[model samples]
Target chain A: MTDNTRRRFLKTLLAGGGLATLTGCDYLSEKTWFRDTLAQGETLSDVVQHAVTPRKAMAREYTPADISPSFRANGTTDPDAVEYRMLAANGFRDYRLKVGGMVENPMTLDLAAIRALPSRTQITRHDCVEGWSAIGQWTGARLSTLVEQARPHPDARYLVFHCADRYGRSHSPYYESIDMEDAHHPQTLLAYELNGEPLPIANGAPLRLRVERQLGYKMAKYVMAIEVVESFDHIAGGKGGFWEDRGYAWYAGI
Target chain B: MARARLRTVYRHPLPVRIGHWVNALCLFILLLSGLQIFNAHPHLYWGSASNFEAPWLSIDYHWSRDDGYSGRTQVYGWQADTTGVLGASPGRNGELEGRAFPSWLTIPGSRWLAMGRSWHFFFAWILVINASLFLIWALFAGHLRRLIPTLEDWRGFGQSVLDHLRLRHPTGEAATRYNILQKLAYLTVIFGLGGLIVLTGLCMSPRMDTVLEPVLEFFGGRQSARSIHFLAAGGLVLFVAIHLFEVIVSGPVNQLRSMITGFFRYRDEPATDSATTRETRHDG
Candidate 1:
């Protein structure tokens, strides 16, 4: 078959749409089946609309002394690549985070430059969706500054964080994203230091996201890059995050 | 011979039927009432609830609800009005929505959440009773083992997964019965709704949050537990929807007859009758 016909055929066969093509579904009412199937399955677009929020996430506050002696990192202990290990050996002094994707000027800012921007230090409870909680003092540059410097395109809606760690057995890159609102929240920061010292590898060392409004996983660790994009369509599996692709909700706004 | 066999065995217990209807009634009220609560804020970003409220479907109530904790709340349920049998005041039985449907899409807020609390607390007993009895019946009657598949069934499930992945031909008999697909779906609802729900529901209330804190932590936090409760409710609704479709696909009367009267009248398709041939696979 010609490429045109094959493409059209594939589109008709695989494209998700109406129930007219539901062969042999004589038992289920077409409408009922369609509704049940579609409603049960979460779509990326539907999720974005649902997650738009006027409702604010209350940040749980904590005493400075409540910080853990050592915050155990759940995933990605070390990014063993040559460049990352070299930086890790020197304690990320030379590390620079590149911010690009749908931006006017793609720029790389070093840790010092990022720290030079106005900073915020907030001691809040980090609630992990996996059923654990920790309180830590996070100090870093306001995320909004980075977004301002990068000057994300008008259509750009999500701020994607590309981390150095890979999750589970899939070896898939650990990444996370947030809408414009969370990206610019006052408490949201590119957390560089935990407590007083530089962030430990176990706790997303050098630079990590601190989106207090969301669960712990929303805070991408071992940050190597940030991408501002229009939608999550081109991202891995198009659902926005690693866990979200595997049946977990994408906008975990609690 | 199959019809005679079906005539002898029982499928859906009378009490189970009652529970089905009760559970249906409870969930409908819960979802709509929950929607009413959601309408109060109306800004959902993900999961089951949304912040957006349908304007055309708005009912402006003249008054407020009785939650004891909060007052002067206006909300509406999904249905247009209370003209029909199901439309009349649907009570909130131990539900999250407490009381009061949104007013924009509903009539006056009739349910006093205080009174709604009584109904909620009351129906909670109904739920517990129905669920407990169903559990006991399923266990004592060997229905759990029948419903939950074994290692052999996993292969069928895996094959079904590949079929679904391929998006091959229409949903055949394998799709009709609670095939491996059905088993997994049921298993999800069981673990999601049956277990997490009770645990989360307890966690939400100040009185019981402490008791169920450990279990709640297994999922996330108090807020996460509440979110899980909502997610599980959505999952249950999804399960019920697929289940009804499965029944309809195989012929509703034939499926319902088995549950109501206790024996499933299986259509003998000699061409594709290899899955299981029996009067009742009572995974009730």
Candidate 2:
């Protein structure tokens, strides 16, 4: 072939190959089997992270000076639930966090009672899955303290956070789950305060979770209940979280 | 009939050829999916946390009564209208969508961060594994030496640059070995930028951050690492562009065949054959 013909051929070949590959990717994304194959990467990441990282390794804590000037509250800022509105109107005085499910001692603790528990204050960076981070000082009851108080059954393998807020137009209640390893992590907290003040309504007021090592979506906001469960199979969409149900990875460590 | 003969010499090894193709595919998917992920929040910041008011780079859009939609891209206070491409692009319905990159340029060709992340991570693992195996093989097989510029290569660096600018590729036996510029480019892309991108990717992972705290610190912070990662990817894209251009200009079919079948053909000039040419004429 002539040089010009060869060059034209090469261009056509590259463009055709690129278009075909992209179309194929979009097609594959819709397939459940292909998605499952992709999910193997998430499973690999989870296992590798757990194996490499020490269980007790703390997420890097920053000083008060490092705190963000304004932390952007994403997802559901204000819960529209009637009970949540009433509790917020009264400064969460009537707010009670229910802790049950596969636990020996199922109990409900109000905000004051939760604050009275062994509290931990930390200035930690909250990394969102969308790729932004904000450092804020959080003070709340250590999640391990709550787990110990609840006295989870030996069979309990996960702690599911049931939040008061409903996300998106679907009005699906926001929920997240963490394995026992993350639930009992030192940095994990049922945070009620941000930057030394009461957590604002925009930032999941009353209470939110602080799973420091994971992405922000794993830290379920506006938490109302903590349920210890053997598995999250029966949970909403059976993916352990609102975002997970919508195709986000359940393991957000990466 | 008087016709010039061509000599064939093995160029790439089997493992190298496989790794090259796998790396190329992984890079293509990684770049497109990464753009999709970047579209979720088309803004980049410096330090750790995003300073919402002062982003280092941001792709955004403004809608006014007069103008239906004006897509704008800002870099360090400098702004430009990048409508229909960078800041905003036409969606599947041909309506302008407020997305950072165009659908054609992104994997899945839609606004889907979760699926994008899945594709990115999956291909990322493959890229890393393929690169690792290639590096180990290259080391044991002495292919690493060919990629590194020696004193002789350094002395010929100026001549090589001039030759490249003139599109004057080496002929005969000289074509069997990499020139100085080729060695430097390969070394930088394979080791420098490649290693940096992987390290920065690890820095972005919260769990990995705990283990690679020193690496994060070296890059300034997680956000900085992320910015560096984007820049490194751009570098790789640029390298691929030039690499392809060189392949086309030099001899597309011969270059491609050399990579695929591990054999390269150069015009056999028996009259010009010297002792030096004969010495370096062994198969790679």
Candidate 3:
């Protein structure tokens, strides 16, 4: 179908498609296990979303005119730790992002080394969970290329990002994770530049993640380390990320 | 005992009965949780991007020496103080809290945005799926016939509105089917507003932009889509409020019973008028 027709069809489907199948399905009432499976709807949503959308489907790119004049930095805009301060003082010259854990070949790459790798530049909108959006141009090395060089173990299912920012009373270092499927996605990047310049401290200088398809929180900033893991259950508070531990969904695709 | 009797008829089919209650419960969950989600930013813009400099709508709380407590709301830059009711209000514990849309109306009753999102998405999926099945079943089962407004209905639509405003209702045969106003309301809610809300919601999802490029264009951009989504949800809330009011005013017991049991006890005396016999013949 033409794009216009497809869009119209989707609109129609959204109005009249899934009602009785979800509401009047007697099988759910008849079976206890079936009823319990509703809790797994999160995982089901993830799987179904992945199944329908092509793996390489790129997020919409914006023109330079579309870029926001001032992209407001949110959450932990600045990390006050001595190590981060020292690195910032020296313009992140000594910053090293360690990629290890379940990888067959663990690697420690610094700013120059990461920049030397192949990179991609794209302008895209950042959608926050707080119902705001801002667009900025980002330049970064493809994460798939980095992971491939690191050579993850066959059992590695997730890539955990450990950052320098500490938050809340617990002073917990901020962290986030993504599955192997997303790790290898073409658009997933280890960004080091924003708006045609080296990323500012407020924008996670040195290194940050740009998981374009997910919400802003999923794009953890202030790079420090990466750990390949089979499961995220034992990391941080065991919910995958600091925010995830605090009730955010680990798979924050939206 | 040689007297008149009340007539009853099957008005709501089984799927319609199930879809109605499910949609109601899902809408309840979605609206509360959606408000909770909206409370996080509490600001809206027209275009794709928004910085503090340019917000079309905002709810804010401020303190000043002259005014110990104050709340302000700005829509399209028009400012108004809504202190005691909107921007700042008494919490459940009777202490003042600064927020738009009180905690009581929110899902978690606190500023837990993550939990609010969870509740919103969970019910959102249910609402979408339930509406979808209802639409398909409605088409095949001939349920759509009752909802789709006829040309005759269009001509009488104004009269129906006037009747409703005057609290005058039809009797016997005329009351059996939905009035023109009711038909129009159902058609708008089920097809127009319902579809718009869902599409706007999908537009807000960053990932769905690829699939919904045309929809996003139609809505202008993400922030505009968000604004439209919020407005559409409000429309649904208004529709429900008026619907419930009419139900109660018309006759709550029989109206609610029709939905719950698929049978409606006729509101007028039976076998006493030509209308009742004509309706019986139509049913046959």
Question: TM-score, chain A, per candidate?
Answer: 0.77, 0.98, 0.83
Decreasing DockQ order of the candidates: 2, 3, 1
Model 1 docking grade:
incorrect
TM for every model, in the order presented, reads 0.45, 0.96, 0.88
Scoring the B chain of model 2 against the true B chain gives a TM-score of 0.93
Ranking by TM-score: 2, 3, 1
Candidate 1 runs further than 4 Å off: A1-57, B1-284
In the order shown, the candidates' DockQ scores are 0.01, 0.84, 0.26
Q: lDDT (0-100) at residue A127 of candidate 1? A: 53
Query: Which window of 10 residues has the lowest lDDT sum in candidate 1 chain B?
Result: B42-51
lDDT of 3 by residue, A106-142 (tens): 9998899999888999999899989999999999999
* Number of the top TM-score candidate: 2
Off by over 4 Å in 2: A1-5, B1-4, B270-284
iRMSD for each candidate structure, in the order shown:
16.7, 0.8, 6.4
* Residue-pair clashes, model 3: 13
The TM-scores that each candidate's chain B achieves against the reference are 0.60, 0.93, 0.90
Better of 1 and 2 by DockQ: 2
10 residues in a row with least lDDT, candidate 2 chain A: A39-48
For residue B197, model 2's alpha carbon misses the true position, in angstroms, by: 0.4
